[model samples]
Every structure is written in structure tokens, then in C-alpha cells.
Target: MKIAVMGAGALGGYFGGRLAAAGQEVTLIARGAHLAAIRERGLKILSPRGNLHVPAIPATDDPATVGPVDVIMFMVKNYDVESGARAIAPMLGPETMVVTCQNGVSAHERLGAIIGAGRVVPGVARIPADVPEPGVINHSAMWDTLVFGEADGQVTARVEGFRDAIVAAGATAVLPGNILHDLWRKFVSQATLASMTALTRLDLGPLRTNPDSRALFTAAMEETERVGRVAVPDLPGELVRKEWEILETLPDTMHASMLDDLNAGKRLEVDYLSGDVVRLGRKHGVPTPIHEVFLAALRPFKDGDPAGLAKDAVQEFRTRT
Candidate 1:
């Protein structure tokens, strides 16, 4: 199948490169120096499992120049959500499937507004990946497991085709019966960790090891899980506990992509993740003091000193709660 990766950053590069390596017709939409590098030297993937340099893959910055493809892995950053979606809309054919491998709860809906709901698939990616350098993706420590499903929870040919393609690309695919539930479950797990690590300026390895920090992390997780439950009532209550325990088992140095964005001075996903928690809380009349506070603290860094922003956020969270 012809697959076009919209972002081509760490997440897109890792997954798209894998597909390209497996002989799929993959095109990476990129810009500036990264686009140049990929065009000149091929797409380079430095994964924990291995490494590769895709020599003949197509890389471009303009989506209009590229024709419609069978699938599009929409992996753009949170900041470029709409713009990216808009840019890729013209490239989608009637039968094209656009998979959103992004953070936040309503990504599928948000993109659906621009690309039509029938062609949208909500996806949740579980991996630590980022572009350590332009044209180079560093696949960090985590299983390259992906879960996605059709918007209406109906298993369709497009969904199954995506599953087969992903598996052929050498990653795990979770074809959940209910994609929304699966996506929300991952959001609960990721939102808690991203906020805690970015705020504390510590990796999960150290943060989970500290008594006070661990407690705070758990509290945040508990609060987020509470918010998620109210937002998604169908989610079982005990699932949060399992999510927490599973997170505890990951490598301590594990930092959410938000933390990486914080350190790099790039825009963070606080608004969609924890910030969404606060928004939903207000909508449901649920008290979300923790999430609200974290949003306030992280706002300063989301723009400029996001690294220091996270530090201050943690300190303030520690002091207040």
C-alpha cells in the first residue's frame, strides 16, 4: 500500500521508516533541513532494535505535490494539528485512511472536521521516539506497539489493512474492538506521566523511585484517571490501577514526549493532555485542582522556558499538594 507519513518526525520516522523498510511505498512529508537531509541521505532510523537508512524513499514538504495514497499516518505535533490536517486533506482519496498517531482525546474528531469522519482512524502509539537530529529519528526505550480502530468501532477493510501493513512493518498492532476506549485508556496513562515528569524535571526512573514524588505522581494519575472515567464512563474503574502499575515497570529514564518537547523548548502537549483533563472536569463539574494547577504552572514553559516551566510546575505542585 502507498503510505504517506505527514510529520516524519521521531514517531513518524520510526514507524514510516519501518514500513518503507518492509517494502511499502512510503513518502515522508517534511520541511527545511530535515527534508533536505532525508532527500539527500535517505530517511535514517536509529532504533533500539536496529538501525537503517532508507535510500530510495520519497521526501517532500508539499503535500499537494504528492498524489493520494492508500494510507496516511498523521503524526504531526500538537501545535500543527489543524494546519497539518488541512494540508493533507487534498492528498486523501475517497478510500484513503488517515490514522492519527497523536496525543489527546479528540484527535480523530478534530481531524475528522477537516478530512471527513469516514476516512479517519484514531490511533494510540506506545513508544519513546524523537528526532535527535534533522533526518534522524531516535527510537528510545519502549515496545513499538500501536493500537488504532475505526471511528464508529466497526472493523472495516481499511482498519484491517492498516493492521496487516503495520505488522508487516515489524510493529505490534492492537485492533481493539472499541478504538475510542483504547485511545482514552492510553491518554489516561500518558497524560499522568507526561505532566509528572515534565513538571518534576525528572525521568520516570528517578521520579517513580522517590517516595514523595512517587506519591505525587500517583495522586496525579489518580486524579487523571478520575477525570478520564467521568469523560469516558465506559472505562472500567480498576483500569487506572493497572495503568499505574504498568507504568511503574517502564525504564526510569522514560520521559513522556512532552518532557522532550519541554527540554527542547518546543511547544508541549499540556493543553490537550492535562489541560483537556481540566476542561472536561469543568464540563462535567468534576473538581480537577491538580490538573488545573499543572496547566497554570506549565503555561510559562509551553511558550518559552518549558524546561524551567516544568521544574517550577513540579515545585509548585509539590508545594500546593
Candidate 2:
């Protein structure tokens, strides 16, 4: 299958490179030094499963050049959903599947509004990957899976075909009966970790262990669940509890990707994760005080801290005191 990865950062690059290595025609859409490095030396995946180097996969910044493909992996950040959706228009064939692979549940809808709902496939990616440097993906965990399906809950041929391609590329691909519920289930845990970890500036190990932080974490999950139940009406009442149970099993070193972005002074997806919960809560008459606090506190850093002004102000205040 001809595949185009719209945001070929860690997540997109890892999967795209693997598919390319497996003999699928995959093109990476990226920019800056990362794109340059991929053009010069191809993409590299430093994974625990095994190291891989796809020496010559097509990499470019323009989708018009790649043209239409069998599938488009929409892996851009949550903030870039609309712009990215518009950008991928040149690559959408009549039956091309545009898989939404960002955090947050609303990406598919936003993309659908721009690119037609019929072609949008809701996806939930479970992987620990990051671009430590140009063209290099640092995979920190062993859990690597991609769960996706039609929004209508039908197991269509296209969905199965994509799953087969992913498995052939050496990664797990799950086709859940209810992708919406699966997406919300992931959001419950993801938003909780993203807020708690970034706000505390700690990893999951320390955050989940502290009694106060643990309580806050549980409450945040509850807030997200309340909103989620309304979003996906069939969402199970025990979902939050089950999600927390799974959280306990994750590696202590694990943390939300937002924390990584926070430490680097890069953009955070708080607007999509916690902020999405706040919006949904308001619409559903659910009180989400915890998520509201997270949204307010992280709003300033949503774009990024390129000049370190926030940090500088805190330092100056400390010195004056």
C-alpha cells in the first residue's frame, strides 16, 4: 500500500519506517532538520525490540508532490489538526483512509469536517516514542500497538487490510468493536497523566506514588470520565477504575508525552487533552474543576517557552525574595 505519514515525528516515523522496511511504499511528510536528515541518511528507529534503519524512504514537506496514497497517517499534534487536515487534501484519493493518530478524541471530528467524515478513521496509538534528534526515533518502552477502526463500529475490509499491513510491518494493530469507547478509555488515562505529570514536573513513578498526587490523579481521571461518559454514552461506569488499574502496571519511567514537551519548553497538547475535557464537561453539565485548573495553569505554555520568560520570571522573583 502507498502510505503517507503527515507528521513524521517519533510516532509517525517509527511506524512509517517499519512499513517502508517491510516493502510498503511510504513517504514521510516533515520539515526542518529532521526532514533534511531523513533525506540525507533515511530514518532510524532505536527500539528495544530491535534497531532498524530504512535507508531510502521518500521524505518531503509537500503532500502535493507525493499525490494520493492508499492511506494517510494523520499524526500531527492536536494543535495542528485543522491545518494538517487542510494540508493533506492533496494526498487524499477517493478511498484513501485518513487515520487520526493524535491525543484527544476530537481530532477525527475536526479532520472529518475538513476532509469528509467518510474517509476519517479514528485511531488510538499506544507507543512510547520520541525524536531525540534529527531522523532518529528513541523508543523507550516495549509496548507498541495501534488500535483503529471505523467510527461506525463496523469491521470493514479497509480496516482489516490496514491491520494486516501493520502486523506485516511488525507491530500490533487492534481493531476494536467500539473504537469510540476505546478512544475515550485512552483519553481518561492520558489526560490524567498529562496534567498531573506536567504540573508536578515529575515522572509517573513519583507522581503515582505520592499520596496527594495520587489522589489528584484519581480525581482528574474521574473528571475526564464524567465528560467521556457523556461523549460516548455507552462508556462503561467501571472504565475509570479499569484505566487506573492499567496505569499501575505501566513502567515507572513512563509518562505522558506532554511532560516531555513541557521539559523541552516545546508546545503542550493540554488544550486537546485536559482542555477538551473542560469543553465537553461544560457541554454535558459535568463539573470538571480539576481539569479546569490544569487548563488554566498550562494555557500560557501551550504555544511554548522559546525565550524562557516564564522560567526567568520565577527565578527573578526567587532572587528578590
Candidate 3:
């Protein structure tokens, strides 16, 4: 299969590199020093499963450079969904499939609005990886899985073929009975972890170990489940408990990507994670006080700390004078 990995940071780099190693014709779309490093020294994957170095993977910053592809792995940050979709428009063919492996639930719909819904496939990424430096991906966890399916829940040939390609690349891939439900399940846990970790400025070990923090985490997840049930009525009522169970199984050092962004002084995805929960809660008439606090506290850092802090400092000096 010919695949294009749009936004070749962390998640995209690791998975796309693995697929290329498995004999798929893969091209990575990236920018800045990372793109330059990939072009010069190739992409490197350091993982507990195994270390891989694809010395000559094709990579470029512009999607137009690599014409139409069989599959486009749309893995940009949640905020970049619309622009990324527009950027990749020139690479879409009649039979091309664009699979979104983003955090929030609205990515597929946002992409579907630009490109046709038929061309978009909803997917969930279960790997914990990060780009420690340019062109180098550090995969921490052992479980690497990609679960995706058609928007209409059909077991189509394209879906099956993509699953085969992913599995052959040595990653777990599956077509769930209901892809929307799976997305919601992922959101329930992700929003909870991202909110608590970012707000408290701690990792899962500290958050899950303390009784008060754990209760807050549980409440946030419960609120997300309440909103999810109204938005997706078919969602199981026991989803909150199931998510808590999954949370307990995670390694103590685990933390959400939003926390990583916060530590790096980069823009936060709180709007899409916890903020999405707050938005849906309003739409469904569900109360989400916990998530509301999460959004309010994190909104200042949503666009990163630069503009907001500079503006605040100027205002303070003027007021004192």
C-alpha cells in the first residue's frame, strides 16, 4: 500500500516508519528541523519492542509534492484538522482513504466537511510515543494498536486491507463493531487524564495515587460519560467504570500528551479534550462543572504562554502607573 503520513510527529513517525519497514511505500509530511533530519539521517524508532531505522524513507513538507496515495494517515494535532485537510486536498484520489488518528471525536466530521465523508475513516491510536528530538521517536509502551472502521460501520474491502497492512507492520489493528463508540470510549479516558494531569501538573503516578486527585479524576470522567451518553445514546452505561479500570492498568509514569505540551510551553489541546466535554455537555443539557473549571484554568495557555503573558504584563504596568 502507498501511504502518506501527514504530520509526522511522534505518533505519525513511529507508525509510518513501522509500515515503511513492513514494505509499504510511505511518504512522511513534516516541517522544520524534523523534516530536515529525516531527509538527512533517516527516521529512527527507539522502542522496547525493537529499534528500527529506516535509512531512506521519503519525506517532504508539502503534500502536493507527493501526488495521490492509496491511504492518507491524517495524524495532525486536533487544532490543525481543518487546515491539514485542506493542505492534503491535492493528494486525494477517487478511491483514497483518509484515516484520522486524532484525540477528539470531531476530527472525522471536520475532515468530512471538507473532503467527502465517504473518504474519511475514523481511527484510534493506542501507542504512547514521543519525538525526543528531530527525526527520533521514543516509543515507551509495549502495546501498539490502531483501531479503525468505516463511518457507516461496514466491513469494506478497503478497511480490511488497511487493517492487514497495519498488522503486517507488527501493530495490533482491528475493525470494531461500532467505531463511534470506540472513539467515545477513548475520549472518556483521554479527556479525564489530559485534564487532571495538565491542571495538577503531575503525572499519572501522583494523580492516581492520591485519594482526592483520584476522586477528581473519577468525577471528570463521569461527567464526560454523562455528556457522551446524551451525544451517543448507544454508549454503554458502565463506560465510566470501564475507563477507571483501564486507567488503573496504565504504568505509573504515564501522562497525557496535553501535559507534555504544557511542559514544553506549546499550545494545549484542552479545548478539544476537556473543552469538548464542556461544549457537548451544554449541547446535551448535561452539567459539567469539573470540565468547566478545567477549560477556564487552561484557556490562558491554549494558544501557548507567549501572547497572553506579554499582554498581561503590559496591562499590569499601565494599571500600576
Off by more than 4 A, model 3: 307-321
Q: Which whole-number lDDT from 0 to 100 does residue 121 have in model 3?
A: 97
Looking at model 1, the pairs that clash are 205-252, 301-306
lDDT (Cα, tens digit) per residue for candidate 1, span 1-321: 999999988888888899999999999998888899998889888877788889878999999988999999999877678899889966888889899988978777888888788888999888877777888988876488888998678888888988998898887787898877777777776877888888876788888778888787777777777777777788766767778777867876788878767866677788888888888889888888888888988877666563464456656867998
Candidate 3, 88-112: lDDT as tens digits: 9989998999999999788899899
- Candidate 3 weakest ten by summed lDDT: 306-315
RMSD, every candidate, angstroms: 4.0, 2.5, 4.4
Q: Give the alpha carbon lDDT tens digit for every residue of 120-168 in model 2.
A: 9999998988898999998877778999999999999999999999999
Model 3 alpha-carbon miss at residue 53, Å? 0.5
What does the lDDT come to for candidate 3?
Answer: 0.91
Task: Kindly give the number of clashing pairs for every candidate.
Answer: 2, 0, 0
lDDT per prediction?
0.82, 0.90, 0.91
